[model samples]
Target: MPVAGALTPIDWVTRFDELSARRDRLGAVELDELGLAAWFLGRAAESERAWDDAHRAYLAASDPDAAIRCAFWLGYTLGERGEAVRARAWMSRLFELCGSEPDARAGAIAMLCRSVGAFATGRLDDAAEFAERAVALARASGDTDTEVLATMNRGRALVFGGRSEEGFAYMDRVMLAISSGTVSDRVAGPAYCAVVASCLDRWDVERARVWTRDLSAWCDAQRGLEPFRGECSVHRATVLRLGGEWGEAETTLVDVCSRERRPETLENALYWLGDLHRLAGRTADAEAAYRRAAELGREVQPGLALLRRDAGRLGAARTGVARALGATPLTGVRADLLAAQVELEVDHGDLGVARRAADELRALADTIDTVYLAAQADRAAALVAIATDAPEQALTLLRRSWGAWRRLDAPYEAAITRMHLGRACRTLGDEEAAQLEFDAARTVLTTLGAIPDLARLERLAAGPDRTPAAGGLTRREVEVLRLIASGRSNRDIAHELFLSEHTVARHVSNILAKLALPNRASATAFAFEHGLTQPA
Candidate 1:
């Protein structure tokens, strides 16, 4: 009963059922319609079967071009479903069918499929080469849809191949095409998702924000567009979370998960929801979200490790992060894991482990040449310096990190580095500068509603200044006193502050004598009572 040219998925389903009841043989078009309906419904096996049948029907009709198109979609869907071997086999069949004398449009489609295969296998250079060829061939054949896809593919390949500027340039062009309505509706959704993903992967937050806004506007203007809406919503939520809008981010991701029909989209939304919950200190909720994400086949990493660290399971946290770092190759995600490793190792007082992680982060930053990674590396190094009692060196590193974060417009990260800088300044006996930094950081953290960071800052800022000078002791004696109160031995204190053990002993004696304390324990108690042992 459906019109020939206006069949919805429901109409197609109804038609297919009626045809089956009448024992009618379905042709290429019918099979293709069924496949599309099954795909839209997230029925992967059924969709694959329908598409395979459509491909054979097209071949039987001697429509090699239509069959090749079906092959491309089948291969693409298979790849997305993680059936890489079958995907490659379908792509290989397409290549064989096309042979050497294919038309320009067929050649372009074949190259596009090859590019996807190369990208899947991590041969970025080959992918770029194939995508470029596709673009040229499609343009010559006036195939705008293929050209658009090829352009996006080429951009991603170039980005992964370390030509990010050029890659983003191509991506920007594709975005222009999409905005101008030059791209086909079929290509627009995937193109937008690809560009946004590339921007996020490269730590190009500003670009991601711009593209996400554009995508939101585009989605708003369209009615009933489903394929990319969930992905766009996720990207929008990520931008919100990064901008310190945690409540809105939580709401957005929850909405996305509720409406997402695809397993991949639902999994991604749930993972981000877990991240938001964890950040807001909703431990049980975070665990539930993470569990659901895991059930959907998402690997909950660095976030899970951080949750363990927060729960006082330092050993488990250490093992989880170490395993994650070992398994992950060098990439943006690896940089994030390394950053967490540095923080965890520093807290565990494993300065050597922290230093190694920091070194690797610095190397990764240099390789990627991204400002965000550079800032993270500097912050990690600064934390290690602080843990090792090199406050002056820590101050320098923290300043660099603060500046980098500021340049990137990352307010939360900038504020964190400022707080560390304040501590470093306090350690160096510059109370005036320390107070200024603390006040500034407090304002930012409060505005962002970063509860844990604010709480830590409150703890650090609680104690009144009780320097050795005020207690009839020198600054060096005050430094030694605090370390002693922290349970460091004389040798440990000496090593930490880069002092000789004899000098440290002399400082200890001076502190004991001045305070009229009989022993180190009493001195430590005095330090605590006077608040000298509070974090600098």
Candidate 2:
């Protein structure tokens, strides 16, 4: 095990110099506290794999200070690399180890690192708690760097949870700290640009363009930040994706996925790849990537459930969603926010219960003003709009939802929001506007090869004014097929979609023809297989 205790001044300085040397190779066995700390902090400046290894070694060394250093960097590395499980584990460990007393330097840094990791992995509640802890510790010690980092993490988590204005304040503070020369984050942790891009993407194109320009300059200014090169690409890809550069976005994802370093980063690339594919009408490929990303995100329920839902594997998504919602280690606004996501899926599938769930989410949001949850609640409300047949209402909700999601630099969710907005346009009888929106969405999703979403959009591009995801099936056909697949009689089918038995028979015939099934039995089987119907 690595040792974290203090060392003689000369030996420590020499060891630290060796660890910090750009080209020197130091043996892990010879690592001391200062050496390990130097390596943990500077190794990432050397290489990706080396960075994580150093961080882990530092964490396991058992010196409170060394362990604390390791905890911080390791958490960020794990989260950045997409190892949410390991990241969460380290974060939890840090939380337990820190206890109530504030150790200022080590404690503040460790808590900030943990919170940042949590935020990255979709654990906003935990992120908020850790951020607050870090902030308190930083304030107690007057550690400006830790304070800024913690504030940034809190802002990010809040943005994801839907407390945008508050989150923006944090971002503003981060900027202020930067101006105050107190905004140093180890290993380029301060390089996240997606948030700024998303926040300004909708308001003024010139402003966003200029911000991105400055981002390029800032990235270049930080010469030793090469370890975050892939992350930088991810941020740029997000900006391009939001700016409507679909081809560029696809290219960027391909580049990110091809880098072949860090599991978390790979998972992120795959998630976006899957999303882009879905929007682009490439269902088959999208399904494949989504499956892998979901597996990677298995430690966190939200990521797993969203991927499953995108793939239309509802049973699996539902189970994950239910487990996530039912599992109670969560508190404050994050719980309400996550619950809203599950409820939205439930509401989307079960039209009868959508409104109640939306109402529940709204009421919950009223209790806490967090960034991540508020946006989640808005998404749920949009689902309700679709369920209630108010496309305009859904569009309005999507517009708001898009604003929140964009602020967090979460492109995957942003794509979905855009698609929903297009659906609203279709419902409002503006086929041209809908087509543009769908095309924009398709461009993003095509890169990911999202299957079901692609299939729905393809159906829309070729059909009349209808929600792309609802496919080309008319309302009546959707209803009749639902019942027929449920083993309902012709009479039952007619009653369900609201038509005469003769009309229902005609719908059945058309469905069989449309699906190119040879017989009613085949058509019925198809309906069940395609989720157009439920078992009786």
Best by TM-score: 1
Q: Taking the tens digit of each residue's C-alpha lDDT, what string does model 1 give over 234-334?
A: 99998888777788988989999888877988988998899878766778988899899989987677888877776778898888888878787447678
Evaluated against the true structure, the overall lDDT of model 2 is: 0.60
Per-model tally of clashing residue pairs: 0, 30
Which residue runs of candidate 1 sit more than 4 Å off their true CA positions? 1-67, 83-89, 463-536
In model 2, the Cα lDDT at residue 528 comes to 61
- Cα displacement (Å) at residue 449, model 1: 2.9
Candidate No. with top lDDT: 1
In model 2, what is the error at residue 109, expressed in angstroms?
6.7
The per-model lDDT (C-alpha) reads 0.80, 0.60
